[model samples]
Target: MARPVWSGTLTFGLVSLPVQMFTATDSHTVRFHQLQRGTSDRVRNKRVNERTGEEVPLDEVVKAFDDGDEYVLVEPEELDDIAPGRSRTLEITGFVDLRDVEPIFFDRTYFLGPKGKEYTKVYALLEKALGEAGAAGIATFVMRNHQYLVAVRAEAGLLTLHTLHWADEIRDPRREIDNLPGRTKVTDRELKMARQLVDTLRIDWKPEDFHDTYQERVTALIEAKRTGKSVEKAEPPAESTNVVDLMDALRASVDRAKKPSDQPSGHGGKKRANSGDTSPPTHIRDAAAKRRSGGGGRRKGGGAGSSKGASLDTLTKAELYRRATEASVPGRSSMNRGELVDALRGARQHRATS
Candidate 1:
């Protein structure tokens, strides 16, 4: 079993329960070591006295605050002494509807479990109540000498705690961002076409259908380099759309989205003939033929390109991303608009030759 990161007593009103919190997620990003350029020697970092130019032991290190001229040093024990009982207790102030809390306030999540078998009944009761009420318990607790605001709620028959950002920490977007589009206007025709495009492209939510394609490519790059092979360079991003041709772009997008099979399978790349699907549907082949025959002309904001042509350059980043997803292009997730177009073009050429 995995070890819990924190163990503490959770109290709400007259009820108290002992619980252990475990990390709910893990990262799979590739890490690289720092090394000297053109040399095999590894680079390392060390704590050293700047004045004396000598390495300092970790035990001798103390927290310090710079008061303009001089540094105020303080021991770790001094900070702990000031924390009081917050380090061991998680007291819930009250329960509130989970939907009321904005998503921006939420941060890290942790799984909560009863500390022992004896406390299972109490844990189950709380979990049931939270689930039925669709509410979360707001609480404040101290861990590792830092305080955090958290929300405790039931998830998949168990309790989960999510760290929340303090109200003052969230920045106002209107104030932070420049050139805000407060009230943009659009024609009814353009709006209708946009709605049609949206309807055509709507899909069921399936998180398993997506993945960290960029990381997968990073791993592949490492393997290829290890084998003395060259990696392919990605294409540049697409140009911004011209608002003058918004309706044409929307119409073209809707036409493309109508053919769901044009999108790539979840397995990445085209489906194999052995999978009992020999080729695309008749309608898809007809549409591709039509596009190839110059029936699909370039518009100001349209990315409508035939599989055999340079029209891919006219497509927006979002359009390119969709096409990349359909073609199962590797590393598409991390790619900019230009990269997506380049990858899609490469995929098309590969399919044609094969």
Candidate 2:
């Protein structure tokens, strides 16, 4: 069992449960020390006085705040003196429906366990009450000199606390997003096909089913190198073509989803980070360049004189998203229709110029 990182009283009304907070998750990323290339010596970091060019002792290091032309040095003891409180307590402010909080606001999570055998009953009672009510308790607490907004809820048989970002910390999409969709319409048949595709591929989430293949490949590479073995290189996936119709792509995706797991869907396998290919694949760039050169063929039953540039502005949200996907626009998944159009147009122009 992991040791508790923090111990505090969880208070609500007249009830106070003495609990210990243990981190619920941990990163498994491999760590490497900085070293000089071709040398066995490891690099080290040091703190020094900027003006004097002298190494500064840890005890002598004081944090300073810039105030225009001068600086105010503050001692570590001064920070402790102005801390929230002497007694550590996570006081519940109010209960709220769990659905009210968006997933984006959540940060780190911790598990709450009874500090002593005597506190188990109260802890279980609180967990059960929150679980039955289908609600989470909003609370504020201080830890490591930082105040955190948190949501406490029941998970499995234990209480879990998720640290949340303050309301002011969340950026307003209206201000940050310039090209938001105005009014876009989707054909009933297209919408139906899209839903069918989603329904066909949907499955219960099993985290264990997915593994970090890149990390595994990296480990294998290191092992092979140590044993004096050369690893074979794998081919990259082909780039997607510019989509002329949304319904056609959705239909093809649905068919692929229905196919057996062993069969390939023409598209390449996911590119692993260990592959060391930083630039976008050649096929994607080529395809984007082709699209930018007015390679979009005439729509079925349409004349060759049809305006391809003007047609882009009249595309549905689904069609715009498909184009954005082909162009590999970052964060395109969350963008609105107009934003997708703007990004796709910019990507096309960039591909053409570059």
The number of the candidate with the highest TM-score is 1
Off by over 4 Å in 1: 261-304, 308-354
Tens digits of per-residue lDDT for model 2 on 300-335? Answer: 544332223456767555445545555556555445
Local accuracy of candidate 1 as per-residue lDDT tens digits, 1-354: 999999999999999999999999999999999999999999999999999999999999999999999999988778777774648888999999999999999999999999999999999999999999999999998889888899999999999999999999999999999888789887899888888876665665555545665676689789989999987643344334457545545655566555544755555433211211112232243444445576755434433333433378765455466567667776555565557678887998999999
Score residue 317 of candidate 1 by CA lDDT: 52
**In terms of lDDT, which candidate is strongest?**
1
Error of 1 at 318 (Å): 11
- The per-model lDDT (C-alpha) reads 0.75, 0.71
Q: Give the TM-score of candidate 1.
A: 0.77
lDDT of 2 at 122: 94
TM-score of each: 0.77, 0.70
